[model samples]
Target: MNFLYEKITFIFDPLHHFWEHEKLSRKISIMLVLFFVLSLLAIEAKRLGILTGPLFSFVPTNHFYAISAAFTVVLILEVISLVFTLPCSFSRSVGKQFEILSLILLRNAFKELSKFPEPLTFHGNQEAVLRILSDGFGALLVFGLLGCYYLVQTKAAEKAMRPTDLYAFVAAKKGIALTLLGIFIYMGLHSLTATLAGREHTDFLHQFYTVLILTDILLVLISQCFQPSFYAVFRNSGFALSTLIIRIALAAPPYYNVLLGLAAAIFAILLTLTSSRLFGKK
Candidate 1:
């Protein structure tokens, strides 16, 4: 228990102690949410086709764009997303990561039961994962750029660029590291699901989940620029506003298209609130 406690503390220590209670509270709240969502997923596992249709359409599976054009679009999206999202505290920053991960995990489980009703084809899953990796790299780039931008923006950051700013510099570095760890965990989980489950032979769970994750990465990137501004609004009594936007964007007429919508609105709201506080005051 002591070892586990140390591990947990270390994972969270990068965040300030002022945020300790908030993080623990959020962890519990998210756990409850995980339970409810997994329950829904277990039920939806019986109806797979509807679930996978959305994921397939979300990814340009055929690879139509030129490599350069494709790369540019991804780069732009990541930069825009991170430009808006990076300012919210580390714990707040990762909310969208949880949201997207939750959605993909559930969606993939459903895809497993429906699409490959016959034999498992796990290698097929790699296609979606590959696209997500491409996007994730774009996200890493954006986060990298934003970290530098924020470092320069900080008073301590701008003061000297000295050895002592090293603490703040390290804080920014930890943020980047945490974000990367999330991506690695996502990939590892995707692979593990296919390999450990009998579906390893026939499952495309990895593929669909990967594509969805790219969208998740984008959402988090966007939060970097605006999370603070938006949260101020939320705490001021904008209860349903954020949820409404997310729901509207996610409601893909026929189904929610991962790449085409605001799949992670909560982060957007907090991000917007945070950015406004910093940049919009009178």
Candidate 2:
């Protein structure tokens, strides 16, 4: 375990180190943006038959699908940012996760547009219409819930944390973030290689949430060191439960999946708001 921990630290330490340096961080961000743009152009060219390669066939031809795919990449970056924020404020991190999930739903809604028939009438594509409606509604609802969470969080009382404890918490969270980064790299490469090799590629969101669930569990365990009250524990656990619900939604049928995801967000927000009111009043 010690060896594994050291290896993870070695791999992820550079990310934390670079993030501390403003110039280096900005350069990395610009590089990522350039890469994303180049990827989109390459995929577009492949679709247009201007480029010939084994990967061309896998590239999404529809403009809507291509745009949605790009947004999914952005969502992944947002989740990475959330992971980095976990050590500082758990509530804020949870809020960021909610935002990412909502964006994922929005991306799905965009993807649904690609499924619509060319004429795009309501009669022939009822199923697609339902999917679009469900996804769009779910995205809007989650965004509203996120706004409420932010408000509740701002009004909530701050926990008194010792400087030493804060340092320890940040260090532990950084290690976990590095481990998560490693897992993400492995999963992404595995999925891409499998797809290119003609094997079944794993569902990206499903695999990601599975890893996220484990990370959330680790975070909850880490939170135990701060001697939080019962409500705080409950709230954190609720966030984990919310993530699980979203993961389960990924496997459900179209409309049902959106409904389930929205319900989870609603439940989480209500729980947090109630807890804040009760605990903050004391």
Q: What's the TM for model 1?
A: 0.25
Give TM-scores for every candidate, taking all chains together and pairing residue i with residue i: 0.25, 0.81
> Can you tell me which runs of candidate 1 are displaced by over 4 Å?
1-98, 105-113, 120-231, 234-240, 248-255, 263-274, 277-282
Residue 188 CA displacement from its true place in model 2, Å: 1.4
| Candidate 2: C-alpha lDDT | 0.74
Please list the Cα RMSD from the true structure of every candidate, rounded to 1 decimal place: 16.2, 3.8
Candidate 2 lDDT, 145-201, residue by residue in tens: 788778777777766679766656666777888767778777877888887777776
Residue 216, model 2, lDDT: 87
Candidate number with greatest TM-score: 2
